[model samples]
Target: MKKQVLSYWLKDSQKKTYPRLEKNLNVDILIVGGGITGILCAYQLAKQNKYRIALVEKNRLYHSTTGFTTGKVTVQHDDIYHQLIKNKGETIARAYYQANSEAVQGLKKIVEEENIDCDWVDTKAILYAFSEEEAKRLQREQNAYDTLGIPYEWLDKETLPFQTLGGLAIPDQGVFHIVRFLDGILNNLNVDIYEKTKIIKTNPTEKGAVAETADHYKISAKHIVLATHYPIYKRFNFYFTKIKPTCSYVAIAHEFAIKPENAYINLIDPVLSIRFLDSADPKLMVAGFGHDVKNYYSYLDQIHKLKAMATERLGAKDFTEEWYNQDYESMDMVPLIGKITDAPLYLATGFRKWGITSAFVASLIIKDLIEGINNQYAYLYDPNRNKNTFKTVCYNFAMLSTVIKTKLLTVPKSIKINPGNGRIIQHKGSKIGLYIDQNGKTYSVKPICTHLGCTLRFNNVTKTYECPCHGSRFNYDGTSLDGPAVRNLTQL
Candidate 1:
């Protein structure tokens, strides 16, 4: 599904392809994944004039979740400070706020210093309360803000343009084209860039690390950064258990009128986040944040309802494009950054649906690790720092039960599907997926996931097969849907 987002950047984005690793090579660092984090880390590391870095992305750069972000680079998330204070503490909550605030400042500084024309703009971020219960929650959030001494404006219905009864607005927040910022960093860097290079295996030796690609090459690096969304090397950190994956939808409407001046998000159950963009011909309002891919059918109805709400709220005359992006959510609600083990391996994942600021912080942490400097915020994102509290245990337990139920649910062994319908088929002592066309011709493909080899289940509402083990996804005709799985499902 081509979302309306690509049109916003297809013309301005750099189209450069890096060759895959085909032979043994050595570098100071090997950064996996070319999204914002890896790219920014490479740029920062290169600035030090010390480490020779090689960044590898399984596919094209910026086409991942980074490209699909709502692009609001702000520290103001949906009432996070209040929740953090209640769950963690005031000190850690303040640390969280400072870390993100510094990140936002770092981003603006980088864009300005690099002279990147990414349509950067300073604006306020609004968090609206949809119900009275939510409004009371907002009052508590306001208290947290006061305790933290953060600058914000609390408003009622009569003060704002929207109908929300109460809301919180934080000033001096910003948004920009993430791809343009990435391109600004990549313009003339000396780093070795590789695309179409899939890391099939990673073998750790007594000395360092060697990544083996299917193309018969062994690339060696003194240190490794597994920024591949969900780290490909699961053995070191037990990432699959620590952080589960989810997907969200985004829509960019060109014909929308009466756009709001600032980026906006709601405090209610089914949240709606809004951001504005100025394109060449027509300005666009990007609104989304729906459908947790893990529970695709659960929010299938909400996706449509959000679309209608967006159309009605912003006066969107026409819906140009909509696309979905998946993210890994950590149990602690903070991103995982830092070394996974003692052998010079590092990772950054589980941004908890906030990639922009998390990526910025990850880049800083990676640079500090490479330069052998002590980063004060290292413990907050330590991959091995598992303080599994009661809430974390309960959340993972529920997640496991959900996955088990989804997998063991009574699905037809093999059903006769229509041309436009798909079916869950059990074959080869395992579950395989099948899709039929209008002519009743069938296409068979492996329903096993690319990650951990778990058989997938068919999601009737969205018509996609999802992996129970690592949350990988597949389209109806057995096409590989999402990552940690690099390739499409093989046709049988």
Candidate 2:
């Protein structure tokens, strides 16, 4: 209830809670984080009658990124097929499409078997180009699609409501109430799930692994899965350096009239992704472009701009709900899945905005690993792959440069802030942060990020402090609201 943004999907849903792990427990498999991947992984492993799987969440289940999504269950991730071919390889790119395409149908089978009422639909997914340059990019993407034998329909300028160039649409895609879909699956699971159970540390053991909670409770398991968006373990995989945290916003309009219903995305920086809802509460959802978390902006401005775009182009009515979600993106623009450590520990992160397919694929692959079976797609998503791409080196160097650049910045001797406002000010020989609430109450904390010591930035619209480097978030009172920062800002 204290959240700054209310997602359209979560607005009318009843909050579900699971018991917390209060004492040390042992299980055949320990799953940390209760997002879709973790829940689905538990569902798969639990139903297999193999591992005595138990899932734990640091906070409420399904309240994080999973709750705030465009809910498009499709294999089309921008023109990633073409990009992946250029960066990774043709084989990897083909595997990427093949794996996700299978996951899409795999999800359909689950929904049908369980008869889950998540407003499932088999619609079309579109990728539009906004400029001539983007059209050329789309052409290349089409070539890649040909190589992969992925069928698609091409669109001209007149086919769309408003567009600069053309687009491509893939049939057999879907849209659903993802939160409801996840809830439907979770409510029927036989496995034990614990909420508000934060795992702060994990150690590889002779037998398996031991994960310790912030409260010092432990869960010893024969295997552990880090399905959290960004694995909290900083030592292994160098996730903080390899995975770049990006955030994006979304706005919903309950009244809309659009033709040829399909999930759409445009080729633009911070692409504007749009999807429609034909359910009882018919609406249109438009997501603002994603930007690196380190790049701070006026969050309110983003919402305003998104609404304006929807109103002008899509003929959207009054907006009902809007929120933001942060997703991790690896340097190579591919998800990092499977075992990252020598121990029987697996992680799936850097999903970008296409978590639906990625999450399902993750569950399938992790299940295969648990069963000691070889999954062909495992090599494509391997987290330990040599990611020394030019982009990776450049990105990590830029992040480190940000640390050095911020550390040397000169601070003012004194500063003043208005009520209900937050600002970084020089305090006690160090630049700290201070927030003055509307009630004229003051809250102060150190501005250094606990995850990597990067300087923190204030998101005025959300009234929370965020790390520019890795997306750690804290309340004005200095309690950590997001991770991979388990520790809150030091209260000053």
Instruction: List lDDT for all candidates, in order.
Output: 0.75, 0.84
Lowest summed lDDT across 10 adjacent residues in model 1 is found at 1-10
Looking at candidate 1, what is the lDDT of residue 479? 53
- Expressed as tens digits, the lDDT of each residue in 232-284 for candidate 1 is 77455456777777766666666766544788888665677877786454555
Report clash pairs, candidate 1.
Answer: 4-321, 247-293, 419-437, 419-438, 480-489
Top TM-score hit: 2
Query: Which lDDT tens digits does candidate 2 get at residues 222-251?
Result: 999998777876565467778888888898
Q: Which residues of candidate 1, in runs, are more than 4 Å off? A: 1-12, 279-286, 289-291, 298-300, 409-423, 426-430, 435-443, 452-454, 457-465, 474-491
Tell me how far the alpha carbon of residue 453 in candidate 1 is from the true structure, in angstroms, after superposition: 5.0
Clash statistics: count for each candidate: 5, 2
TM-score of each: 0.89, 0.94
